[model samples]
Target: MDMKKRIYLELRNRTPSDVKELVLDNCRSNEGKLEGLTEEFKDLEFLSTINVGLTSVVNLPKLSKLKKLELSDNRISGGLEAFAEKCPNLTHLNLSGNKIKDLSTIEPLKKLETLKSLDLFNCEVTNLNDYRDNVFKLLPQLTYLDGYDKNDKEAPDSDAEAYEKGLDDDEDEDEVEEHDEETVPGDEDEEEGEEDEDEEGEEEEDDVSGEEEELNDDEDDVEEQQGLKRKREFDEEGEGDEDD
Candidate 1:
């Protein structure tokens, strides 16, 4: 059996259920294509790294867990955009010795904000005069390229890195800021409490005023009864005087 079939059979027999890294060099992936051969290694569920050289694959299996992918010496001319979207969390990539001829083909890799390192040592795109400038400009999140500036000393004012340095979130001060957590949450609760208290106070005041009005009405009724009794007594006295 050949090396490709041998490796496939061996790994299948071993039953690599938790395997993460896979290295298949010279597996004739470019010649045989990536769909059918990748189906052979269906046991790789938690695969994170794929070092498959010379694979002219049009589409990769929806490997959401893959972090690093190395596809050197291949002919994936216009698939980096879909590749980046497929593996949205890739941090390391190596596409050296490929037939990528321009920056537009690989510009899709710029959206990979988590990508820290990239390798394009022998690709045809590296021959351009604006190669380094374009790469750094396109992928400002990159920390290392080829071998130069591996530490990313040039990106001191990177807004992406500012979050890591506690620039985006710096609210821990002795003085309170306008956007404080205590201000928003606590203010809502306090406002609601004040509204409830005001409503209760208004209800209590209305009850007291209603009682005062009832007392006034009772006093007026008593005064009207007294006036009627006085009139009746005055009429009875006049009638007695007339009889005498």
Candidate 2:
């Protein structure tokens, strides 16, 4: 038998306690060939670069002891649901350059609370914010992501800048509302001032009308008194001429 088949058959007969790490990367075995081996070595602590064999590896039971899994540069697809269901103790997972397109594929990985690093660089991922938030929500212990430190100074500064921009937008909206309110009051005050001036002018005209009416009444009374005095004077002059 060839070397690859020899290693494969040898691993099949062995139990889980016999191996702590296994690397079958770049091997000549096809898809289903590694499934039997994974069942035989389900408790492996490290597995790496088993090209085109990740989806089959998910069938392995009791893989809770696995710590590091590297499936980079492979043809792995259908998200990380199978891997998360199979390996709950994974700490380092490198799925970079894979065909993972959605965040749901990696949601099952939240059960691996011990995961500290994850790599999804150059994948079909288009939304980083949703991925970062969902990953952070799931894996709080993750400190390194896509090759960058989580506590990097620039990251927090960029977050603060985004927050400040949001606050500035809110403040601008409030200012616009206040300006609108102020203009409404100004318009109301101008309208009220004009109304008050109109009322004052009406009162002044009414007062002028009352003064003219009183003057006309006084002139009529004076003319009636003058006419009465002239008639009495004429009567007194006729009586004096008759007496003489």
TM-scores for candidates 1 onward, in order: 0.51, 0.51
Candidate 1 residues 110-207, lDDT tens each? 88878887878787889999788788888899887774554445534355687766743565552456557557767889999999999999999999
Report the C-alpha lDDT of model 2 over 1-244, residue by residue, as the tens digit.
Answer: 3325645665677665687877766554455334444455656898765454444445445677888887776666664666667787888888887778877777777777788788887778635666666666666788777766655422234558999999999999999999998788579889999999999999999999999999999999999999999999999999999999
**Best candidate (score: TM-score):** 1
Quantify all predictions' global Cα lDDT against the true fold: 0.67, 0.71
lDDT, model 2, position 197: 100
Structure candidate 2, residue pairs in collision: none
Clashes of 1: 0
Q: Looking at candidate 2, what is the lDDT of residue 22? A: 72
RMSD (Cα, Å) of model 1: 14.2
